[model samples]
Target: MGRLGRQDVAIPDRPSVGYSLLNMAPKHVVVIIPVFRDYDRARQTVAAILRCSVPSPFSVRVHVVDDGSGDGTAERLSEQFGGRIEIIGLPENLGRSAARNAGATNISADLLLFVDADCEPSDDRFLAAHLLSIREADVSMGVVEGQDDGFWHAYQQAARVRRDRLARRTFVAHFTTQNVMIDARLFNSVGGFDEAFKGYGFEDRDLAIRLARAGARFTIAPGARVIHRDTLDLAQVCRKMGEAGATTSQIFASRYPFEYRTLGYEAIDGQRHPWRGVLAKLLWPVFQPWTQHDAWLQWRLVPFKLRAGIVRIMVAVSYLRGTLRRHR
Candidate 1:
């Protein structure tokens, strides 16, 4: 019931006042969660952030960007949090890149935190962790840990962990956009997220890669974690994979030409189980144009069966287009 600081937000009781003050700082962190269609999940994410047990030397101004959601997400947010949380409702459906840019444009904070609507910050120190990292680096990546007990969840978690491992080691450039913190000044200087990446995939990776290439200091904050609720059904998964395939080629060609040229997509073929690789190759034609395909291929160096077929088709199309252009 006790209001903490000028924000007038209630801070939960703690036995040790000094411990509560450990992570709190004078400057506040602005957290932005971009939402499109998932109102329920987005609302839950904001609630989780509000409930987080972080210290409170300063209060955080959380922004929920509802990117033209048909769901009453904006109304619910206003009714529930009202002045405590700010809601930005877009008239049209701008993709994640655009929504994030809009959210960042309105936020004036010492540090900016970008998180997906489906993810929740792990603990109070999550913001402090980012601040520490930002003091030394322009951008910092937080780990998105998923609980894997059920069969489907286990499978997905295994695959994601593999992707994270690759990101930490060889492909550090492709950090997950689910939970990341960036210096507001540097983000603006880089022109923010590229709105050209209209789809779901590659936009975050593109931004990070570009920043690193431009000599922006990049580092990982292992302690700052977020849990991503990636509960996509088979059909939804395939649809997302298809979108990945479509955007990945463009992403790769623009960002990692050397990697593409050197190892090619063939690099991931032998890394995973034989059946999974074979199955992916078999489905390539069905899922190739999707964004996830590009991600899977880039990190795993293997192809989904349907996506591979689509990629071949796309390759043929590109070849034909190139020939026509040369002729003209």
Candidate 2:
């Protein structure tokens, strides 16, 4: 996901063919999975990772940070995994970034791996592939494949298509914490994820920028893929994009103004393009509902391109309206 804008992150130059093996593959990895209210999903993910055919099972420790679920999740996991996994139950919800930071405390592992609760590895060799990737770079980010096909799945799969053109090793500019590993010391130095980012979007990229600036090499672990179990519709995606614009986008805009402009967010700036806000305001009511349901997602009566165009317009409207509302 290295989305380096023309003037965004500037990673240090690497030798030809990208990665220069940093060091011999190390042992001891801490896999951190942050869980919210989904105990069953979290349980399955932990079980899957534990079952993976890692080189050294004793060297790897799995830590689950139950983010204020307040349920019996911790106890259940303890009962199931026994001494195999550790559970850190937070008192209250600290959001994604803070929960991850909580999980990173007092780590004894040389490598810190982060995987989302909603995702599980494709196969048992997943852990081994990540371990091998760290031989070439400071950070190793695995790929993601969507499950239970839909528009959201297609969108995620399509977004990954850009990776085919990217080198196996590059900067972490295009990163997703869903399934990634980083050097333990390197992660601590960067101060982990910014807790200021309250919602989705930009948080991973922000962390990537800091890591890249700190001279961290990132490797794309294509073989260590994870299956994203969450199914999404147009409405959920739009809601998230809108929330991102209102919350994370503001923080990002303040921090990286130029890069924000490069992402085409400037087009939605109501202060400059007032007409976009006006147009968005008019269409949001009608198109927003269309985005909110799977019924309209059906292209039986409509051309596929036409449906896609409408979805894009509504998503842009959602984001634009969010930015405008936040600014106002």
Candidate 3:
């Protein structure tokens, strides 16, 4: 490990890189993990990454962008890691998009791997798989195994199975920032993430759509996997989902109206589904309690299928209500 260093960085207005699909051999890969006050997890991930084994002809540097933790977490990480990883401490809480954009300052890096702070690489091959995947695709999205419960746990875990592990380079439509790698040039060509996304939610999806539009190919790098440590209850999930719906849902819709409709956002936020919002409000009492552990409708009593359905409805209601509240 080298001596501790703090990197002060700035992104210029509308910077573009000349991207080449032919040269997929990466000489340098900068793993950017944007974190907000997640010190323990960040340290663990960075340490694990530094320990990982990589293929020859390519080197890995971990870049951590502290997004307004304001808690000296970045400095602490710098102290612990020394010069093994680069740490950028932003003065204030910039949204996720801006924080990630800040970490994309390594102009010499051929690949920029964005891994959420809460995740840890699954094996030694984690970095190698991502490096290998981009040889055939523009963006290499990693797989994940998680310790979670309730709907989100099931949903995230299910995401891993959606693409067969056998299909290493299986093309995927959806994208998330949790564990994904993209060509540095291609990411910059699309202006990186749209900082307009204030909170969480569609920022990753927004970037994915832009990347797709720019002819960026996506693949599922099965061997490149991580252990996602996020675990939240129904209410917590609702809160985050609602935050997304309230903050970035409309931004996404206004920017991509056709995608908004095609994605089923039209049904709830659309003119046709006004009654669904009202219905959700009317039934809020019955289902809202379910968010609490001791709610009348206990998950233990209810059948698995019905319980899943109820949980799904509760979340949808929270999200839709949030989107509707924007208009009010």
Best by TM-score: 2
TM-score, ranked from best to worst: 2, 3, 1
Over all chains combined, what TM-score does candidate 1 have?
Answer: 0.69
Assess the local accuracy of residue 220 in candidate 2 as a C-alpha lDDT between 0 and 100. Answer: 81
lDDT of 3 by residue, 1-328 (tens): 1111111111111212324434556688899999999999988888878888888888988889999898889999999999888888788998888899999974588889999898999877788888777776677888767764555566555444543441232122245788999988888888999988988688887887777666566666879888887766777878886787777888888876655655556666622478887886787778676687724334466675566666667878887777767753
- The Cα local distance difference test for each model comes to 0.60, 0.77, 0.73
Residue by residue across 1-328, what tens digits does model 1's lDDT show?
Answer: 1212112111223312222112333366788899978877787788877776545454678988999987787898789888979998899898998888888885566567899998876676677676656555556778787644343344555556556555433344336678888766657767888887886466776676555544455567888888777654334455543454455435554466544333233233222234534555565555445534344433234434444444444433332222222211
RMSD of each: 12.1, 3.6, 8.3
Give the range of the ten consecutive residues with the poorest summed lDDT in model 1: 1-10
Give TM-scores for every candidate, taking all chains together and pairing residue i with residue i: 0.69, 0.88, 0.85
Candidate 2, residues 111-224, lDDT tens digits: the string is 899999999888998998998777767788898889956555655655565444332333433478999998877788889999998787888778877777666767788889
Worst lDDT window (10 residues) for model 3? Answer: 1-10
